[model samples]
Target chain A: MSIKLEHLNYIYSQGTAYEKQALRDVCLELRDGEFVGLIGHTGSGKSTLIQHLNGLVRATSGALYVDGKNIYDSSYNMKGLRAKVGLVFQYPEYQLFEVNVLKDVCFGPKNQGLTDEEAEERAKKALAQVGIDENCYEQSPFDLSGGQKRRAAIAGVLAMEPEVLVLDEPTAGLDPRGRLEILGLISRLHRERRITVVLVSHSMEDVAEYVERIIVMNKGSVMLDGTPKEVFAHDKELEQVGLAVPQVTYLMRGLSELGIPVRRDVTTVEEAREEIRRLLKRRETCGQAAEGQ
Target chain B: MLRDITLGQYYPADSVIHKLDPRLKLIGTMVFLVSLFLSHDWIGYLAATVFLAGVIRASRVPFRYMLKGLKAIILILLITVVFNLFVVPGDVIWEFWVLRVTRQGLSQAGFMAVRLIYLIIGSSVMTLTTTPNDLTDGLERVLGPLRMVKVPVHEIAMIMSIALRFIPILLEETDKIMKAQTARGADFESGNLIQKAKSMVPLLVPLFISAFRRANDLALAMEARCYRGGAGRTKMKPLLYEKRDYAGYAVLAVYLAAMIAIRIMR
Candidate 1:
């Protein structure tokens, strides 16, 4: 489903001493089946914006339209939107309360009014999608390691079969391998299921490597929104907001500054490797021509 | 949703009551609570109302905000009112099947409600004006004499203060867990009593887990910092009775005397 936010603003503790505008006139639209990256530091309105999509948080002002329907209106069914737009919160494993992993994953589908058999069936498929083995299905979710618990939690949201998945910092506090595994799993789901995915994260490398469209927020406003290549081009501006471009982008820049002509927007090690190889080939050819002279 | 709870919250304002020594506030709250119970008639209640109104104004805490704490006890207030309006024996005002409304009952219920309301507001004023750290220091100092009798006074105060600090945090955590479950379509509302209780399983399990995790982390952190049961601990800002504290005590003593005198007049 397509999602559109028009001049959306959200203020926490409104009219109180602790009043804060968490979002300021953010306007954006996401087309169907888009892979989008929401980049921001902590408290940069990224989480607040996604929460609005599912109606978990209402915008303080402005309009949010999900698939052409105004969400904040009284007549709209918020539960339906929430079911369609599954949000996997940060540290979702803490929400696990079922006796077993499979049962926990089935909670969402059952809540969608599915029959027990159908709910279990959907839960099984979701568990498999997240690479959770059957052996772990009957075990207590608390018994699993951190990464496994995270996957089980994701499966809970996946079982709801949402058209759009919004994950807020899914790989936070995980080790490197676990982080890559979770990211890879999410990307695979997006590729296979063709669901619209909005990944909110602080890691520039992950966003650069995975998503096509990048939206960066700073101080409760959309600072930049474009393709990853376009956004990273303004790395200096990102730095001023306490954000940075991908490590590979810096590596490419360093290579270019050292007299090697390389593409500076390369975001992955593989892309950097190709750029370095191309530079080396040109250097060797130049040396041979000079020797011939 | 849970973020809205302002219980035990300190309102930062520069005011005379806010500047009072926390120990004095604590003692004053106790004195006020006792006086509220001792208050027998409308005169004592009036003295209470005047005293409470003055303190609340001095603290600069919003009146509407203080009333928010009353929301949680509305049911108890109603029940007390009902019981007091029917149960006490006196000249009957109204009669019905298995229930008799009496003058004494009505008056008793009215006094009970007033007393409870005053008790809550008086204590809330104390907490609202004092920061948790100051309260902790105040508690440790006031309860210091208990240490001579082999009581773990510092530890008790530390635990109380920590529990106070965690109230808002745990509420936020509970809210998060509730929202997580709600997103999964777990209906917390629109359920029968049993069903509502059952639905809370989803909320409470996560809350407990996170609470334990936080407690574990805190214990480790405290131990890492060589927190050895508060022994030999010296305060950076030791508790000292300012002239304001003495002045506060004088005001409280006068208020208490008025309360007792009003009770005698009735």
Candidate 2:
């Protein structure tokens, strides 16, 4: 279930005037059950790097291994690899083409050569996993609302039951509530399925809240790889690369600079609130000691 | 798979041919193709060849590219040449068991090959120099007079424009769908013919679905903007016959007349 890339380099439109070196030599790995957040500015090779995981875009020169199998090996089965590493593209709903929702969600499982009955069962379960009602199964996918379409598209991949789920900006273009719902669904899937989740996003706050580990990319290379707290500690360097620490982390750092005795590593509002409460209690005890003296 | 297609491919450059009015270039290509067919002898072919060479040089499109375009149709060109050489009865210059090579046959084959080559080179010059949008605009302007015969010239032009616009978008969509299926372990390459065709089902299903979706969206978008199809539609950039265009037409007319005169003389 783990994915590894060794010395990956990608050059787009190779040998053409439009040739762009999208990814430099980069090495990274994601183990099973780890929710890794990949953050980078636009054109920082974040998309190119993730696309390599499933062999969507083969590395111009490098090696990619999934579950101890060399993906680029001539003997490897690409279609099977794709089934194992399910990549939900950005705005995947655009890829939906079936007349109805059920058929569309069954597309992947059907391609995997499952019996029609088996595929239908998988599709139903997958639709449920993504929180889509069974009543909507017979309706046209096109008739669904934007958020529902997004969910159905995700369920289409989930139907394949991939061990490694790589999502590219899954929450993009959604309203605030829809964004939260999708993120919650993703977190639940990661927890219940124990799937390796690689979420590519630009929002530091979203990554900080959900992902246990963060890999920051800058200009086609890995800039930092650590826990959210460890990565956010280099706020200045992150800012230099057009990235920023989470707002809560920023606020904590600011309070620490003013001698507020708050920890600068807090990346969420709840943690910040608890830290402030603890500091206030300590201050009260110190004030009592001064009065007693 | 779709990305490999080079249709509407424009090589960006600052050459003189690139600066010429697209309408003029389109007409020039038609005139050049006609001359290639009208030429009856080596003298005529040589004259056309020199003229084509001049156009190619001015356009600044690499000669190798014109050759590449011809390479795509090499089989058809070869068939034409062979058919003319072997099938046409004439005074035999060389004879084999079932093969006869004659002076007239050789000449006809040579002329046909030259004509086919010139036709490809002439049109490729137009594509290489002009962008797809400008080429469609030029086509609409050139065919505007067909409206007198009740032909839907404007509508056809609009369709052409839309089709051209969708080419790149469809190509990009195809690339995305192919990659998606490939990620799912759909083997597109290294399979037997049946396997290959089977693999295409996933790619095609997604591609066709996206294409229809795009078309539906585009239609809705057009309707939202009150697009009423070619009726009383005003152009943002109206087509005007400039002095350069007239001069280009004059040159083409002279070339056509000269080719006709050569045919008659022959």
Candidate 3:
């Protein structure tokens, strides 16, 4: 399903002393089967924007359309809309309240009105999709390690089988290995399931590695929205917003500054290495010609 | 969602009330409350009201904040007023629909409502002025006598202090959990009573489990710090009753005596 937001604004605690404007006229769209990355500094409206897609937060004012229907329409069923767009919030492991993993994973599907058998079947499939072992299905979710609990929580959302999966800071507080594992699972799910994935993260590397498209937000507004290469090219803008480009991109920029012919758009170490090798080959040829002279 | 709750919100300010010894303020608040209950007529009530108004002015807490605090207890104030107005029978002034509006009842209700309002405002002023750490320190100092009676004064104070410290932490945790469940298509709003309660299972389960885990971590950390209850414990900031405390006590004594005199005259 495609999601579109137009001129959306969200103000928290309206009419109170603590009122804050969290989102400001943010407009964006995500096409079906697209792997999109959302990057922003803390308090930059990334969480606020995603919450609108699932109708978890109603727009204080503006239009939100999902699957060609106005999500904010009076006749729209918000619960059903949420089922279509799954959201896995940051630190999802904290939300595991069920005694066993299977029961917990089935919670979302059951809420969607599926029968017990059907929900359990979906839960099993989702667990497998997240790489949770079948034998651990009946184990207490609380007894599991930190990463396992996080995966179980994600599976709970997956069991609902949302067409658009939005994860907000999914790898926060995870070890390096666990973070890569979770990111890999998300990539695989996006590819094999053909579902639209929206990954909200602060880490530039995570987004640079996985997403085809990147949407940058700063201070309650969209700073930039384009393919990863297009957005990351504006390194100065990202840095001004207290966000950094990927380390490899920074490295490439540094190389370019030193008069080495290198692609500034390189986001991965492998890409940077290959570009460096090409530059070295040209240098070697130039040196041999000088020696021949 | 949990972030909207604004209880025990301390507004940090540099004022006389904030600077007063916490123990003095604690004792002074208790004395004020007891005096309010002892008040029988408008004179005693007026004395207490004037004293509270002075404290509020001295503390530099805006009148609007006190009014906001009063607004929270409006329902209870109304209940008390209604109960006192109808239940006490004396000097009937008017009657409508089996409801007798009497002079005594109306005055009694008015006095009771004002008294209760004052009570809430007075105590709220204490909380508003004092930080939780200072409040706990004051409590431990004042309730030290209770130790002889086998009361777990230190433990109770420690619990209160810890709870106050964890309020923001738990609120952030709760917000995260709610968001996690909301992402999973959990609908906490726009549902029937039963459905809404059922939906909370996802949010509550995670909150409780995390709380338990936090408690475990806290216990271990405390143990690592060599915490061993209140036995032989020393305070970093020792309590001292200054000349102002004596002056405060003298003012309270005079106020109490005048209230007693008013009662006797009545």
- The CA lDDT of each predicted structure is 0.91, 0.85, 0.86
Worst 10 residues of 2 chain A by lDDT: A12-21
Q: How much DockQ does model 3 earn?
A: 0.53
Write one digit per residue (lDDT tens) for candidate 3, span A1-293. 89988999999867554578999998888999999999999999999888888887889999999888998889998888888999988788878888899999998998798999999999999999999998899899988898998999899999999999999899998999999999999999999999999999988999888899999999999999999889988999998989989999988898899987898899877778889899999999999999999
Supply the TM-score for candidate 1.
Answer: 0.97
Q: What TM-score, over all chains together, does every model reach? A: 0.97, 0.82, 0.83
CAPRI accuracy category, model 2? acceptable
Name the 10 consecutive residues with the lowest summed lDDT in model 2 chain B: B1-10
lDDT of 2: 0.85
The candidate maximizing DockQ is 1
Clashes of 1: 0
Report the C-alpha lDDT of model 1 over A173-201, residue by residue, as the tens digit: 99999999999999999999999999999
- The candidate with the higher lDDT, 1 or 3, is 1
Q: Pick out the ten consecutive residues of candidate 3 chain B with the lowest summed lDDT.
A: B1-10
The number of residue pairs in model 2 that clash at the backbone is 5
Give the CA lDDT, 0 to 100, for residue B75 in model 1. 91
Give lDDT: candidate 1, residue A99: 97
Compute DockQ for each candidate against the true complex: 0.81, 0.43, 0.53
What is the TM-score of candidate 3?
0.83
lDDT of 2 at A120: 94
